[model samples]
Target: MQERTFQLLGLLGFILSGMFFTAAGIKSGDLLTLGGSLVWILACLIWLIPVLRDKDQER
Candidate 1:
């Protein structure tokens, strides 16, 4: 349960940070900011995969 919460937190952070990065990119037109957002998005997906698997396993 703790691990699941951590995973959820990670996902939330990634999404929120990604939005921040996207906003920064839109304001400044920075490639680095966009890249960072992409990285965070990938991390969120990675974290989500395990959670999905765990749910299936539980069922």
Candidate 2:
């Protein structure tokens, strides 16, 4: 449960970060913001894999 909570928090952070960075990039025409958003998306995917694997193993 604790691990799930942490994963949820991480997912939330990734979503928020990605949205913020993407919006900033569009508004400012900055490549760094776009890169940051992409990185956050990758991080989200990485974090998601373990949670999904755990769920699959439970059955």
Candidate 3:
């Protein structure tokens, strides 16, 4: 259950970054928002590391 929550949080972060940063980048007309969003995605993956470790252990 906790692993599931981690996965969900990462997925949610991706969706939010896609929507929010797309708009922010378009409106701002720069790479700043878009570039920062990539970092946001990396952080989201960190949130899911525990789930990934579990999957690796299963194999």
Candidate 4:
């Protein structure tokens, strides 16, 4: 797969994680949702960081 695919998935995951975070905020007591969002954000970073590092190397 292309690097663009990873970049897109990372962005999508980040957005979805934000939405989950908002939901967690509204719910207040939902630790599960908050945890899930954190994990999602981590996964997104795992994907995005490599792409970003490669970009920086190019520059």
Task: Identify the candidate with maximal TM-score.
Answer: 2
Q: 1-59, model 2: which lDDT tens digit per residue? A: 68877877878788887888888898999998888897888888888888888978989
State each candidate's clash count.
Answer: 0, 0, 0, 0
Clashes of 3: 0
The estimated TM-scores of all candidates read 0.71, 0.72, 0.48, 0.56
lDDT for each residue of candidate 1 in 5-56, tens digit (9 for 90 to 100): 8778878887888888888887898988888887887877887897879967
Best-first order by TM-score: 2, 1, 4, 3
Among these predictions, the greatest lDDT belongs to 2
Give the range where candidate 2 is weakest over 10 consecutive residues by summed lDDT: 1-10
**lDDT for 22 (candidate 4):** 56
Weakest 10 consecutive residues of candidate 1 by summed lDDT: 1-10
**Candidate 3 per-residue C-alpha lDDT over 6-42 given as tens digits, one digit per residue, 9 for 90 to 100:** 6777678686866688678878887888777767767
For model 3, the stretches where C-alpha displacement exceeds 4 angstroms are: 1-7, 26-28, 54-59
Q: Model 2, residue 43: displacement in angstroms? A: 1.8
Question: Model 4, range 25-58, lDDT digits (tens) per residue?
Answer: 5589777777777777777767777777777797
CA lDDT of each prediction against the hidden true structure: 0.82, 0.84, 0.74, 0.74
